[model samples]
Target: MSSLPPVTWLQAFEAAARTLSFTRAGEELAVSQSAISQRIRLLEDRLGQALFIRHPRSLSLTEAGQAWLPSIQEAFERLAQGTAEVFGPEPDAPVLIRATPAVQQYWLAPRLCALHRAHPELALRVVTGVWTQDFVGEDVDIEIRYGQGEWPEMVRESLGEERMTPLCTPAMAERLTTPAELAGTTLLHAAGFAVGWPAWLAAAGVEEIERDTHRLWCDTQVMTLRLAAHGCGVALAHRRLMGSAETLVAPFDIECHTAEGFWLTRPARRSLREPARRVWEWLADQTGEQWP
Candidate 1:
């Protein structure tokens, strides 16, 4: 285990280094000025490095302090990003549909307009992310999860089989005619997808191509699909997600099926509320797919 200074000490040092004033750092952090000084002292003692140069009336960052500030600031940024991804946005309805960010932004968000038009009396909320929500106790009534149709204690219904195909804008589609031709152009992949470029290429019987040729990888389907729609490159995306975007086009007829799928699920013990059941049935109708 590494023996770095505590987070509070690091925070105190970062704030003091930025402002060059302990009093100002304490004011910003809502703490006593003496407390800030004490923390900094403890940190410097631990590291055995003089971070700040103390003068009679003025203060300035030493060589060591200037170098450490950027790393500390970057750590805080990553922490905030992780927090947002885990907790996600707040729900505004008693009946909430929880799913991944890609589905929420591209597929479900557009369908919500039709849902409202069909039944304005029903109010609904959606929570989006790549992480799974706590359906056992949370207020989420319906969850569209991406995986095998098994959730231990939850009731699972088949939304659809997950199919992946290469998609691009109409302008970009004009240049491609066959699966082999794709190697000449930029290939995009969603890093989080169950099936990616490797599986799609293998299914298409494409072999012995350069892997480094202008390729882009995205962490989410929303970004990957949007990049394809904007003509950035050809992205491999789910059939349903690709259908949602009007600007995207599937130039080839080849597609690959993955092991995972979108499953409409809820706790077996807690049946969906009345309003949630209405939306759930409407989703089944909108997709023209059967559900159990």
Candidate 2:
């Protein structure tokens, strides 16, 4: 393991050393003066060196402290530069948007091409998965989620209702002639939507359908669609996500209601930055007719 002091400690020490006052350092770092002293003490113990010579009325740097100050300040400067480059507002750079695999592949990818064509200066980086909420903690500016628009401490805007239907490959479609045939076929399910299969079956006028009968279960909509396209089994999928080749045939005429819908979420405090707002508007425009 690395023996270096924690980055937090190093930062605190550098700030305190530069200003030569714990109170001033705390003011710069937005912490209490006592917290600054504590951090410096921790850093000194970890490094096994004294960084400051405490006096009655003033603080002075020891020889070791003076030698370390320049390096520490430079290190922090580099870190700040790197962080700004990665997350800073650069209008020409690609904006990072987080979503699940299904939405990225089916909904966003196609529309993004149009966005790029219109604003070639703007690029897109799509991050996918259930853990994507962590992206907000990173450089990501916006996130598209399939939920009920109830995310805490975030600005949630309803994108639209993603209506789902029973879809299958051409081969699976040939085998399933009626809604009753679904019981015998391999029913593929996605983990994200808890009520996909049940809600779809209810809409199809079928009751008592066996949930345990599902042969394939995937966490991502992309995986479910891939399995469905490859004739793994009949899958209940979002109609908007289905491509011409993927949706070779419709298994059932009846469409179902999903408990979850697409929503645009961002940090409640941060103003919708330009790139993020542009993408949001584009998505809203694309789904305007279908959203209710």
Candidate 3:
């Protein structure tokens, strides 16, 4: 107590040191990036040493910081081990999860609320991703990815069926009552799938639809579907991604199914804690399949 800095200072240091950036450490700690920076500064002042050299674009640990990091890491690891050994596991700790925005907003939100109602103690920290790199960094416990599930070192299970069809606003659906009517309406296209309006149109016998017709191309599925929802255009989206019970009208009986769809993946070697397992199994259960 005589000379030791506060415990938060050491924690901020450890996280910043491990991440090599205060911003990332703040994200991991669920605090502001500035807070992480401030605590480290206070620690530096208390210890009479500069822990990090702050550059315009990066951070580097000073000699004193490098010398102190090992002890800090060991101490935290020991605390975790001791806590697990004596007090058992902290199952309520937020489960870090990364999901495609489509899944997070439309497919999983209500179900998650249901899950929470059932197990009020279980916690989840859901983040959304649209690109391959959006799911990178931060050791997320579970990922809802949109792909064919070929990621190496990940145990994958497909979610829901692979069915897709054209959806639009109710007003638009009323007007474009038939598949042929889509020729005049804007076709919202989201990239990722090999198939799109071309395949769906062919399948629905929607030929004669002009190539010169208006179309909106987007990089993410969520955005394409969003524009369609707001009456901008028709989105060819997976049936499972349409957010709720009554929203996003399917204007046609014709729909297509492919082998590609959302897949839930986690590291093959990592084990889910009790709470995280509950959320994982709950998601798998939503699709009516058991996750390996």
Candidate 4:
């Protein structure tokens, strides 16, 4: 063939050949029967071959139409497949979690296995830092902060209250049974934490002990807990931060109510994305605690 027929003419020919009726093809293509007949005639004139046999009562495909039918159907099928592959069923977006090191290490890290099992399609990104992050310029979708749940412009929910108590290795706890015993023994301290040896000692009714001397100090609860679990000293620890770590024990029954607590916060202006919502709900389920 010198030149191929136009696409509309080919489509009309294909439809008319498949149905063997110009009226049925017209109904399928949302065109009039005369329009289908005219286009098929034009296609035949272009190809110099009769594509359909016309009968007064019915219609049938010509030899040439029968030959071309398979190719046209296969072409349409390939286009549909390619289109679906290019634009269908997008992958899930990654949920970003920003948290303090203690929460990231103790609480969130341990519960991630359950989250992954629950939401297998969700991708997770965890970023840890010292302070509560502002979401205005950050990519965080969820944030866990250790403080009073009072972020002014953010949507804040309390995970739980952070009650501090003295924790040590099981061996150390075996020797010291009373709150008074914590004063004379080695006391571990987390640097810059509001709930420290001083506050805990006061709560335990042992305020006369030296606050400055014979203490092990670290920058984070992660480090402090590790040191205390390894028989360094009794460290002031948040209850949730223990997270089924069986190596540590609370020696004294007295607990101090700290001004700080763990909070789950997000930006108030924007709604959470799908992945973020899954992670948020997963965190709530894992903790079995939530605040209004």
Candidate 5:
């Protein structure tokens, strides 16, 4: 009676096209692989055009399928949006954003309050990981990663330049008046960074120190900064990740202006929902404000 195929066929086509694997689409849609394949076969037959070029172990969209996918995706997005507008937003619907543990604990943790105050209507859920930028999962909408901004398969937007400096408690700052005085206090080391006590000491014009200058090693910069804040030792950390050192002080004017950077990124080729787009822009605008 109607002039079109069933919505299920279109859904099957969309899912299969997105995942490029019938088994994965079936997993996402909670159906069998055979069922997904059958629906797509029916869809192609109904439209009188081949939708996929199926190989022994994989699938790729044909020209027709590629052109028609955007309409289906948009239709589904609008339907969900309209349903929410007519009724109410889902209780658990929040924009999922991911950042590394150090960024979450230091940089982003301090500014979340301002973001929430500005957009109380938007719900944000934050998750942390130490993986590289290209490793974000499929469901995450936005990500803030720390590196040289060179990850593949994603576009990175800069958050301005950040530099590394020595951070210590107020008392330690008093004791560390000169580069030569570093021998009196413990030296905190955050492993895996190119710049450390050696480079910083060199910048401060001190070649070497005594072997007994107390030292502490840590796997993460967040932990190193926390230890410094608690009067354990002095930590050399980035300007952006200076939250844990709120009560701490920079003992010297010396800083390491390395090639390292922080970036805001999202998966390539994915269209952002309205809420996710707002948060992304907000994060970019945060660079202009005073950061702790």
Candidate 6:
């Protein structure tokens, strides 16, 4: 006949064996010392073996108990690890997000303040770059990309679309009365989107202008807009990100849709984690508003 009391009895035995003191084990398990001793006694009786040698001042493990202790400890440890992986404080490791500087500074950064207010425990790491790279073996958990939603082994969701319009300082706006007048002024180019200048020019019906004539170049859209705000030149910027910057003003009554948009990408397998899922949902909600 089999002789095992129950899983709880095994837990009590393991705790008692490791501490070698019923009182301490009881405190660890949130039970009384007498209760702990009783469970151990019951388990020993069922197994027909003395697990511990009780003494007036101390306790010692019997030969049978010594052999069983290691297995009991390993079993408990495995169970604990499994439980934590399934439902516990999700690995306090920082979650990394990859994005361009423009989106980070103008769009994601402001909304993250609200996220911080709501979820104080979540840690965010932002990585800015011009092109997408292999996320495998990288620290990135999520990526906010500007392109068509087409990634090989990752899940993709469109966050928002971008509309390009000519922006300059108020003084520059007054001088540049027509699109053709922009030929003499500096034109800013943001990295990774070379078509912005031509698209704007075509929309404004100005074919005589030369895009390659611009001498100034910036790596990010945010930097280009900043340069324009300081009257350095004119920049084609996304309207959604221009929320309330008073220094930059759009003129010429011309706007065109860019071939690219914002996308949230992550490994399909890693997306199953709770923290990643939560961040994805938050991003989708933030960009759900209709653009003005």
Indicate which candidate wins on TM-score: 2
lDDT of 4 by residue, 160-213 (tens): 666887788889889887766655677777876767778877877777775544
How far out, in Å, is residue 261 in model 5? 1.3
lDDT of each: 0.77, 0.75, 0.80, 0.75, 0.79, 0.77
Provide backbone clash counts, one per model.
0, 0, 0, 0, 0, 0
- The deviation in Å at residue 55 for candidate 1 is 42
Q: List the residue pairs that clash in candidate 1.
A: none
Off by over 4 Å in 6: 1-90, 134-137, 211-213, 290-292
Q: Compared to the true structure, candidate 1 yields what TM-score?
A: 0.62
2-43: candidate 2 lDDT, tens digit per residue: 777788798888888888999999999899999999998988
Q: Tell me the lDDT of candidate 1.
A: 0.77
* TM-scores vs. true structure, each candidate: 0.62, 0.67, 0.66, 0.63, 0.65, 0.65
Q: Write the per-residue lDDT of candidate 5 for residues 1-292, one digit (tens) a residue.
A: 2586898898899999999999999999999999999999988888889999999989989999999999999999888765553433444568777887787776687677778997889899988766454345436777887778887766678777778888988988998788788886788898767667787777777757736478889978888888988999888888756555678788888887877777888765555678877888888778665456
Model 5, poorest ten-residue lDDT window? 83-92
Global fold similarity of model 3 (TM-score): 0.66
TM-score, model 4 to reference: 0.63
Candidate maximizing lDDT? 3
RMSD of 2: 9.9
Q: Give the Cα error of residue 64 in candidate 2, in Å.
A: 13
Root-mean-square deviation per candidate: 10.0, 9.9, 9.8, 16.3, 10.0, 10.4
lDDT comparison, 3 vs 4, better candidate: 3
